[model samples]
Target: MTSDQLVAAPETALPTLRGAVAGLPSYVPGRRGTGADIAALASNESHYDPLPAAVAAVAEAAGRMNRYPDMAAVELRERLARHLGVTAEEVAVGPGSVGVLQQIITGLCDAGDEVVFAWRSFEAYPILVELAGARPVRVPLDDSEGHDLEAMAAAVTDRTKVLLLCTPNNPTGVPISHGRLEAFLQSVRSDILVVIDEAYVEYADAGSGPDSLALYRRYPNVCILRTFSKAYGLAGLRVGYAITTAAIADGLRRTALPFAVSALAQKAAIASLDAGEEMEARVSAVKQERARMAAELAAQGWTLQPSQGNFLWIRADDALLARLVDAFDHAGILVRAYPGDGVRITVADPASNNRVLRLLEAHAA
Candidate 1:
């Protein structure tokens, strides 16, 4: 074997990780492209440029980079609390929605505890659970490509400490209805933490998704996770937060890394909230594009689920998917595809959206 070849270290040489991270699947982000014309639709990021207010806030805060941010994120949390009609103590801000989720898992779980969530939802669920030294129990999606809530409720056992529900679920882009969610919560144990992950809520229609704040009010265990990264075009700044009961929020904050939310991120997020009207206009544009793409794809004899998020899903089999992926790759457009699953194309500018439609049209030909 060469010097670089793998060899097990002697017991005395060094310690190894308990879970041995080698087993964990890597989280693949949306692919990026170097070509100026290449549309980046793989990540569910907003295609719009950052809002003027957010840009100004970031620029102003950039000057204060020399100092550490307020570790507790006092002003940001207070502002979010007022906006969301919750107490400051009920909010926990972190690096991103995923980071805040890590803090949540750490706060709620002990070693070998179980965390249940739908399979093929957010890819991070299992990774975060395992990192917390807990087990991830995956309940697969139903035939409609939506969460099998009844099955999920059945999967719960005494060891289950956390249950995640992703509205406008990642990859598939389906939202769980408010009535369905309320019923599911009623069936589950009160102590089990039900996380309502609304990362794409801004894009979802008013009728489709759960009224999470009302859910949180009725069910104390229900926590709402929201992010500035999606609709606000602040993905680069990485600001996300959790709204929950004061007790749970306190635990989440305790496990967070100090100064994880930078001054720049806090400023940008506050500005994004203040510029809600501008953000709404941008989101409306994305929705219109999504509708147009969905209609055109259907017209081309393609089948896709009704999506409420900022992406379109085509559940292609592996063979066709491979061909489609190659076409997109050669065409210099980036889109997210899961082997043996489907493809998710973010609704972007007309140029990018047209690229996707043309690629599909070529495949059809």
Candidate 2:
């Protein structure tokens, strides 16, 4: 058609999202509670103030805000490398563990490549995979509300490029045991990258989850993904990292959005690492509270999996989920509810924990 004719015709279409992005489910963040009386326990963030050192570092770093962040995040990556007993070349930093995860997917997978992980785990897994134009193969959780490793292994095929193992998996809060995970690793193809997502590692008891660092040392294909957002209480700052083979880490760094992590975030994360002892003390308190709450919940006749994360998961069918959702809403308490699955309530301070206990006491089976 002539230019005039084409201009005269109504536009048939506008710029559009890729089909993969358009067809994907929207990520639904937990509802935030704004009022004083409201108990905000939905997001599983550490319900504590940022560490003193971290706060101070952020204040110091703020003066440098006019400058661009170090594009390579060399300082932060080096610090993380030293902390994890790896070389700087083997570390990659990003906006969050989820952001690093995005880099991982895009760097490794081509269109139609497959990524396998357990269902009912981190909600972001499939989203990131699909966004990279990769197929997400979800293996159903076992009867105990944890990864079905055998099923996940069985699901793997020639096209599979990655496997994600979320220790102390989100929402359900079940961790993969070291022995089982090691066996699973041996069964899987050597070429596939296995990402051990340890976002809640600090909250887990010493031996509860896979020793991911050790696993990474043994398997070059293994990648360890972690965040400062959980027990370190740096959710708003948005920084996380990955420890992988130098080759893969370099590829992830190359794929990362430029200066995605800020100077303030880098400083705060380094400070948090330096204040490990103080952070450990806070984590110990949360562990005690978790134990107390678990005992009380069990006494109330509610069956729950022992959670290694800083949150408790109560498996509920549709009816019970609806009832709990309504109750929490009316009580001005926010908890994450997964339709057809269950509810995840973050372990916070004593008063908030008591509030949750009282509410659940009334609804126990």
Encode model 1's per-residue lDDT on 1-365: one tens digit a residue.
88889787876877666663757888889998878978888999988999999999999999999999998999999999989999999999999999999999999999999999998899899998988889999999999899999999999999999999999899899899999999999999999999999999999988888999999999999999999999999999898999999999999999999889999999999998999999999999999999999999889988888999999998888998899899888888889999988889999999889989988977763
Stretches of candidate 1 exceeding 4 Å from the true structure:
1-12
Cα deviation of 359 in candidate 2 (Å)? 0.6
Error of 1 at 122 (Å): 0.7
**Which residues of candidate 2, in runs, are more than 4 Å off?**
1-9
**304 in model 1: Cα distance from truth in Å?**
1.0
How far off is residue 198 in model 2, in Å?
0.5
Candidate 2 residue-wise lDDT at 5:
72
Total clashing residue pairs per candidate?
Answer: 0, 0
What lDDT tens digits, residue by residue, belong to model 2 across residues 1-365? 77767655457867888899899999989899789999999999888899999999999999989999998989888888888898999999999899999999999999999999999999999999999999999999999999999999999999999999998999888999999999998888889999999999999998888999998888888999999999999999999999999999999999999989999999999999999999999999999999999999999999989999999999999999999999999999999999999999999999999999999999988
TM-score of each: 0.95, 0.97
